[model samples]
Target: MKSSNFLKYTALLVFAIAIGFFAYMVNASKALSYLSHDPKACINCHVMNTQYATWQHSSHARDVGCIDCHLPRDNMVNKYIAKARDGYNHSVAFTFNTYKNAIKISDDGAKRVQENCISCHASLTSQMVKNADANHNYDDPSVATGRRCWECHKGVPHGKVRGLTTTPNNLGVKEVQ
Candidate 1:
């Protein structure tokens, strides 16, 4: 009876240790996220090779990784769901070479990103745009609603901060003459 009791206690202890280890890993991951970004994480499969090279050469390379601009912040549960869905979709696409068949982004992604841009740039909204004259009209729905920003800023790392990110391979609608 004593031997059996000892065995059960040992099993319980092992289970507790396993749970602790998992918790430790989760906690450690939050810190790791801020330390560095692995660009290879984006290209873990075949779907990413095209944008992969262009992203590497962009001025956005200096700072602001892919996640910084694209993945908008959200509540914990929503964030978890978003990350899981993205991971699953990317994995399947990579496995099947579906990224080569990637379609142009629909309006959904852009609209979501427009909200994030507003959140980040809220400080600038009240300030007049650099070239605005006193008589210039200012209440356009596009600017007020953040839609106007995307017209000229559709490329990665938006704004004139770095201009458009173009690779030697794709420079224009036709070709980079």
Candidate 2:
């Protein structure tokens, strides 16, 4: 009976310690910051500094934030699910220092950005959509696939930051040729 009790206590202690450690790590990492819509949360990782800096000078800076363009406008559950998934993926990548030097958005992220662009600029893009359908062959692959807004408006937020390398201080390491 005493041995069983001892084993039970040991298991409980281990669980408590595990929870405590997770809490400590989350606190240290400022994980709660990511829950907010603040753009600053994105720059928590130094690698995003360039994106953040470019965004500051972009036209959208006055109107929208990082989350506005990057996340979905779905229900709260869907939104938070995407946020949690992204936060976990980002944490793992940043923790392992496995991110590419020139950051690239995942396919899922690209889809979300495209949806956001359409939703936000519906007034402007609605006409473009009508024109494209009216003028072009809808069966053509180029027309059928539809053009992503960023395909033409690439400099909106990040402003051609892709393929450009710079230090955290905004010093360009390699000029884009």
Candidate 3:
């Protein structure tokens, strides 16, 4: 075989391997499910089982979902963009086992959640804003005093005690079809 043909075949083999690995990862990760609004998608990774179980038992389970509180609701494009970015970050963190035992939300994620909380409870939040001051500038960090709803309601969906080992019985999270 000529030197050119040997190199060509080697490159083709490498490309094939790369494609195969990518496909395998996608299937193994159930990556396509992340595109859906199904809350069960979060439990695809066992690490999220506790969250899933807790949320399942929460008041919001019947009316809201993980995506509603976690992702941007302003538009479909922003929602998916945030989802993809978060998915990549989570994948990297989980793949390398670099995540903390007690996972905490990122700054951006906290902001998104806060905005969602207010959006969902706009009537109540509007009243709070009015009572806070006459300006009705609750969105402004300086004016609103930088308070998160979760700060007061620590056990909204996920309970107060949260960690990798905190809820060992989280296996109660059922597999959704």
The most accurate candidate by TM-score is 3
Model 3 over residues 56-122: C-alpha lDDT tens digits?
Answer: 7678888899999999999999999999999999999888989786678999999999899989999
Which residue pairs in model 3 clash with each other?
A: none
Q: Give the per-residue lDDT of model 2 (tens digit) for 116-160.
A: 987888876676656766333233576565656677677887775
Candidate 2 stretches with Cα past 4 Å from truth are 1-20, 133-142, 161-177
**Model 3 worst lDDT window (10 residues):** 168-177
Models sorted by lDDT, best on top = 3, 2, 1
Candidates in order have lDDT scores of 0.53, 0.79, 0.81
Q: Candidate 1: RMSD over Cα atoms?
A: 9.2
Candidate 2 worst ten-residue window by lDDT:
168-177
Choose the strongest candidate by lDDT.
Answer: 3
Candidate 3 deviant stretches above 4 angstroms: 1-17, 133-143, 162-177
Per-residue CA lDDT of model 1 for 39-142, tens digit only, reads: 54554443444455555655665665655544557665655565566666765665576664543443545655556655556566446445453332146545
